[model samples]
Target: MSRKRVAEPGPLSEHVPGRKKACWGILTSQGSWADRSPLHEAASQGRLLALRTLLAQGYHTNIVTIDHVSPLHEACLSGHVACVRALINAGANVNAATIDGATPLYNCCASGSAACMELLLQNGAHTHTTHAHFPSALHEACKRGYSQCVESLLSHGADPDYGVAHLGSALYMSCLHRHTECSRILLHSGAKVNVGRDSDSPLHAAVRQDSADQASVLLDYGADVYLRDSNNQRAVELAPPGGKTHQLLLTFEVAPRTLCQLCRLHIRTVIGPSRLKQLPVLPLPSLLTHYLEYT
Candidate 1:
């Protein structure tokens, strides 16, 4: 996928006339990016009553600071759903980004605010980033081990394999940070097991973190143990010798697949990650569906 800069935002001229063009490296529209206001204070502090009063008094919902962070950003980051709802209802830009390229959706992920995530997505917040460099919303969720946010973003079309040059893939971040559930969710969602920053795979991340369980999960999902990083070191090379993770990877290298394990892996691969959600609804017997859900 092209990493082109997001398109320049249109102006918010109708909201306020004296403002300059929208900027977060360029354009969104006529909203005022003035110094912080009472509205910002109210939103960030979770003062819903104060926020409602300000909005009732005509505080522009899109008013931002010099960096272009709107009140919606503040509310979402703090997990203040009432404030978030109020701001969005008052016309806050659901997709407004900071100069650093943070959208309210990104903030919701960063804060692990799944409730705020639902509200924003319902308000039409863009899940896929328009910018090339900033971590996508999905990355933020996985990095923080926010499994609920990760699941929601995936359900909303967040790319499971979206990667940044420095952050690696979302799966890499999850395992490197020792987020077991997040890593499992990413793998089950069909994120490429071997995709990582440069040549490092998620298996490399799991081993580096000394997470035996994570490494085992990656192996189950077909992570390539022999994959090398920039240093030409395999995942086992990063492990402390004879440690649990090193031992686990070593075990995976030598163990023949159990027939049941092979069958499950084959079924998942054939069903494809994108289609895994269909398992519950398929006409398969309950016993089969229950077994499939184990992974």
Candidate 2:
């Protein structure tokens, strides 16, 4: 997507008058020039001053390009918090989606911007909005190892188990990418450790990454060690021979859990996924709370 600054000082000029028409260009697969807009340019470049000036001049905040991408989408995708705030305050639709169905919140996740994500959520961005053939915001955050973005989305009521079409859940994406912190935060947020059918489980994805740390986090959060994949192979069987992941899985298979670990798992199950966050302040000892939280 290319943004051509208007040469004359119109109500939506991005530069000083007569400043040589510098254009900020973004390479894209879509060759159609009809998708470009001045609002998009201002937001994509984090031009807060120009954006506000345009809004003050009565430019529509909800204007979209040919593909239906709004200025709010551009601002959030670029991680421009000030521009995002300005657009939202000017009545931009926080949940505006592109023609491909990518929402502004999804763009924020792709950018890994917790501030932009938070601002969009505060302005009523829908957490359940999913892109066509793409995952939810939480899934995008996990795939990119954006732990803060994951936390922000989760805190604002994003569903941890919201799976992508044919791509499994956020936990699976985190495990697939070997993002230990992202996996940990998802587990803490009560994501299913063994979600998906057969080979699509988070454990299976973790084994595919050959990451002992990521596998351990899943196992610690109560992932089933003996679950079979589509090929009837267990996660341990999928691990590379003599690898750290294989060694770690082998040990886990043989070692019995401590009484504390069993109690934590049981408590988590009883509390249900959404209520798991309340355990930290449920009159329990701080150490026990930390242990339950896997801190």
List model 1 lDDT by residue over 1-295, tens digit each. 1112334456456767566564343223554444566787899899999999989987778877767777888898889999998888888899888878889999998889999999989879888787778658888888889999999988887788888877989999998899999988888787888888888788888888899999888888777777888899999889999899888877878985689987987787788877877899999999998777663
TM-score of 2: 0.86
TM-score of each: 0.86, 0.86
Error of 1 at 45 (Å): 0.5
Q: Pick the candidate with the highest lDDT.
A: 1
TM-score of 1: 0.86
| Clash count list over all predictions | 7, 0
Error of 2 at 195 (Å): 0.5
lDDT of 2: 0.81
> lDDT at 258 for candidate 1?
82
The list of candidate 2 runs beyond 4 A from truth reads 1-34, 130-135
Model 1 error, position 253 (Å)? 1.9
